[model samples]
Target: MTQVVFYILPQSLDNEPEDVSAHFIQACAIAAFYYGQSNKVFIFTDNQQDAFSVDEYLWQFDGDSFVPHNLLGEGPRYGTPVEISWQPPTHPRQILINLSSNVPKFAINFQQIIDFVPASETLKIAARTRYSTYKKMGLTLSTHAVTNDNAVESTKKAED
Candidate 1:
């Protein structure tokens, strides 16, 4: 049974297009922490651009640390803890973190799925739909509403 979790990011104050960069960095930090715990993570983006963005941010997310990761179609780099892609992982079965607008097709492949809903109403609605879909699928659902304070706490927990 796949366990699906949604980590809702703090709502943006302004009405600009949700800057996902900070969220991505936070996601990367969480993934890196899980990697430390010996879990492999596959991050699914909506498209190649998002994948590239994640790839770049992962490098600079932590100046002192590094997360072993590669973009999809780069050939499998054995020992990489993280894999970022626009498509589902070539080989399934890992902790999946989805940044896609819609629920990924391969959501069932992994034992666990982590997704986030930003401040945008459009995104919130989409996430709701995904949540319902997951519910209908009979998967376990867990949600964490991330505020700035808790976001910092999560980062600290990940670091520890």
Candidate 2:
């Protein structure tokens, strides 16, 4: 199964470390839902001792109960796949989810949310939007565009 991994970083690492930590936890919940599996969702932080604390907070949400299998101390490794086993909801709903922040080098994947849509029409719509955004931006079709387009579209709608 394809997996989505998000590298969590503190927003400032200076003034608002706590807020950045809170945002990281919230992002994990969103990531869990996007991946369509809460059970096997894995988060990687900046190899800090406090990283587990953020994971603990994220696991407390309803439908967000997941066990942590820490990979921090595994030592220098390259391209290791994190294991995940998520039971999808019996009846899923179409949701226009958006996650944004004034941070650089952030990414989210569409495969995370694709498993939840049971309808072909909804999937097609998502695909079209994803394609259109990629065409406009001249960037490769990626999960980041699918996730970022929500914010871009919202801004366009607001301006219109």
Candidate 1 residues 1-160, lDDT tens each?
Answer: 8988777777642222244454575678678877776788899888999999898878766667688888876746453788899987876547888888888888888888887777778888998998998898889998877676667356444323
- Compared to the true structure, candidate 2 yields what TM-score? 0.30
Which runs of model 2 end up more than 4 angstroms from their true locations? 1-20, 35-41, 63-160
Q: Each candidate: how many clashes?
A: 0, 1
Highest TM-score, which number?
1
TM-score of each: 0.85, 0.30
Error of 2 at 61 (Å): 2.9
Instruction: Give the alpha carbon lDDT tens digit for every residue of 1-160 in model 2.
Output: 2222222222222232344343344444454443443323334343344455544554553453453333333422321122111212122222212222111122232223211111245443553554454345443332332122242132223212
Name the best candidate (by lDDT).
Answer: 1
Q: For model 1, what is the C-alpha lDDT against the true structure?
A: 0.76
State how far residue 139 of model 1 sits from its true place (Å).
Answer: 0.6
TM-score of 1: 0.85
Model 1: runs farther than 4 Å from truth? 12-22, 75-79, 155-160
Candidate 2 residue pairs that clash = 34-112
